[model samples]
Target: MAKDKKYRKKKLGSYPLASVVFSVTLALFVMGLFGLLIITTQNLTQLIQENIEVQVFLQKNLSENEVVKITKILSSKDYVNKKAGVPQLALITKEEAAETFIAETGEDFVEFLGDNPLRDVITVKISPDFQATENLAEIKKEIGFIRGVYEVTYIENLVHSINKNVKKISYVLIGFTVILLFTVVILINNTIKLALFSQRFLIRSMQLVGATSSFIRKPFLSRASMFGLTSGVLASALLWGLLQLVSSEVEGMMELLHLEQLLILGGSLLLVGLLVGFMSTFAAIKKYMKMSLDELY
Candidate 1:
């Protein structure tokens, strides 16, 4: 009798499980792809913001000490980008600017006009958190107040466009993610229901032999959890494979899609799979548990 019970327990949750895992895995992989795209967009936004340089032109005829003072002030600001504990600020002296202009335009303006019209400038890359239009304007106002600073300037239109487009993209992607989640739930529920159809009679036989409802649900739920976990792992594996293919075919792809971020995405997928799988299985089993013998036929 004990052996028979063990056999029944094994058979109840083990057969036809492959189809459930495949269906859930495919759904999760699709969702994972979209998740990857969303994170990529975020990364691109940061990269663009890092390149948005704010040029701080200095006052004319300033002494070396004054120039050093201005540089120190700008470097101390919170908005300035940093790398490895060093501020990313560059000073382009008027002499270097004239050389660059002469090289580019094929005309030595300083030699022609007897003066270098270009001003010495300090350029700073603003952090992404301060890349908003209003934030940049405030930064310009604050930096312009610094002594020996002539003018603070940046591409205002570019900043506005980035802020606007980021909002729009976030809204669109979030909407799509929510819609896909709902669709996946339906797909998983339907797939699990059909898979459980063949087991309806076995479930009824268990009940006829005085099995309780919770007892009957145990094996199915246990198997559902297992299938959910397997599906999540398989889905994550497929996503990793896709990333590998992309990184091989496309240069610098890994820079935008980082491995550390994968942990959050993978955890989300595992959670979704387990939650949806377990709930759908419970619901399907309840329906069978409530049905009469004729309904099984």
Candidate 2:
């Protein structure tokens, strides 16, 4: 019977170590998942931003000098930051525009025209943030009102739809992140509790020996804090590894994940681990504190 009791004591003594390992592993997994979410959303945003375009039709009578002037004016606008702070404007000369249409339709009517009927067109790429259909329409109206612009064509409906869809996707991502966070908290709490459980009897024994509740709680809190700190480091390491792997396969992804963002993410994970470990330790101690010796047996 004494040997059996000794074995039980040994098992209980090792519980905190096992719990700490479990908490750290779980934290690492959660951090990796959050990193993936950040990377994917950033890539999607960039892809959508690059696809928004605007086309400006020049007046039929406008000369090459006039077209160049308009291009310069448009390039100076504040919204041109979509592409390296330079406006994505392409000056399609009348001849080139005609050739493009002819090539697309394979039309042989080049010889029948009195002159190149196509006007000089300036193509503009808009930023994704301004892609709301109504907003884009207002912008089109504004552009159309320009003195030399014959027409401004932008797919307002398409841009509005894209914005709406992107908003919905963002909401879904937020919901999933919340769920993931809660799941991580619960898993960490349980793992830490199991680790603290081993010390419950020791805590009770101390209580019988007239150890103050605060005194009994000190060692557990210290151990739990250590576990929390270690888990946070583990999470950070995991996040770094996952981001490295993702960067290897995707170009320009490092731009989205700045040091500030990574620090915020790591800080949150660490805070979570600390809170879980402390709360679990406190709860375990309280449970044993209120128990009778018979109850413990």
Candidate 3:
């Protein structure tokens, strides 16, 4: 009976299991929240970048064949955006442009001018990497020089402003991420250390009974690693639930959620949890092992 009781105590260890699990879960939850924020911000930035369009005005009276040829040339350029293996370039006829303008402004400009003055335009959405102001100016000049092209224009000021703001946002997010990562490491480390504090006597007892340091640390590390994995899984589930709730409540949110990015974030959290748990457990065991009996008391 006495030996069985001792065995059970050793198997359970001396850590506060519930407290450790809760603490680790809370830390991972905060980290996952920040990960979601970063992913959503990237998606939002991409959406804005994709909306920046450049108008390629063609020379007036170009035949249908010429217009088709111009579109093919523009689509082949490296600067253009591509989705699903196709270039995001659309050709708009002068008549269609005029009709759209009239419908938007609620004015019959065609009646006043007695002719369509708008040129057939190829609306090009540039790749996000090439949306810089200088790159755009070079692109405009290059496209303007293309045969059968009349003018190449875009909202230059808007593009410059977007780039400037995006740079600032990126800097801010980077700083925040660094600080958050540091905080998370410290928090998890402290939690694991505290949990191990109650096990100091057990560790010392095993050491005194001819147990190697690795033997003494093995079970504690294993339990801590399990704690980490469990906490990470719980945190990820909570994050997914929160996202699903938000998507259901908010219109257009489903469009912003990237499942691939979310999966990567979840996997990263699990790995971080395992790493921090094992390292912290190992450190704590080493510290307790080095302490004299008087200090441990």
Candidate 4:
């Protein structure tokens, strides 16, 4: 029983129960959290970009035929956003615009000026792909060329600000992800190395008994892989729990979180865990296998 216990302990690298598993699971969980942040940020950016609208003010007193033609032309353009095959464009007649103005300010502008000065405006939301300043400028020029169209206008400064800030945020997230990846690799590597430090004597004993490197490495590698897989599963569960809690507390976050993306991130964690575990264990085993007795002591 004593010898059997000793052998089993040796096989485990003499690691304290749960130490290696806990360390690996914590690292994977942190990485998963960061991945969720990146995904949410991207979704929010796209949502904001899609909401931007451009105003197309029409020439006064256009006939019904002319107005219908303008609507059809704008709707046919590739840049216009659509939902359920209907273009995301709305027409506000001069009278409606005046009514809205008066409702908001409690002043009847038509009564004050004796004539409504508001022109008919058609507001169309452009697709997220064309929200940039240059793209909006091109779109405005194209819309202006249509007959009976007075002018096309949008918030130039707002568009520029959104594009600029999105680029900045993207760069920062990418840089942080790279750094986190490097850190996680080192963290997992050192963790495995520390766990195997106690197994030096056992490895040397196996080596003295004429055991081949592959024979000695098989059990250690297998257990390391198991530990990695367990850690990955635990990490994924934690991530899912976090997502659920956040979505419940924060409105609209559920829509931002995508199942496909979460699945991919979870898969990536499993892959990272297995690869790192196998490689780190192999390196640690090889180091102990080559160490002299004096060094082992």
Q: Please report the candidate that would top TM-score against the real structure.
A: 3
Could you give candidate 1's per-residue lDDT for residues 140-255 as a string of tens digits? 99999998889999989888998899899889988998898899889988988898888898889888999999999998898888898889999999999999999999999999
Output the lDDT of residue 177, model 1.
82
Report per-prediction Cα RMSD to one decimal.
3.2, 4.5, 1.9, 2.4
Query: What TM-score does candidate 2 get on C-alpha atoms?
Result: 0.77
Segments in model 2 whose C-alpha atoms lie over 4 Å from true places:
1-15, 63-65, 68-118, 249-256, 294-297
Q: Work out the TM-score per prediction.
A: 0.89, 0.77, 0.94, 0.89
Clash number for each model: 0, 0, 0, 0
Colliding residue pairs in candidate 1: none
How far in Å is the alpha carbon of 129 misplaced in model 4?
3.2
The C-alpha stretches of model 4 lying farther than 4 A from their native spots are 1-3, 12-17, 82-87, 95-116
**What TM-score, to 2 decimals, does candidate 1 have?**
0.89
In the predicted model 3, the residue pairs found to clash are none
Per-residue lDDT over 168-238 for candidate 3, one digit per residue giving the tens place of the 0 to 100 score? 99999999999999999899999999888778888888888899988888888889899999999999999
lDDT (C-alpha) at residue 68 in model 2 = 78
> Which of the two, 2 or 4, has more lDDT?
4
* Local accuracy of candidate 2 as per-residue lDDT tens digits, 160-267: 777878788888888887787777777777777666656668777677789898887887787777778788878777778877998999898787666876777788
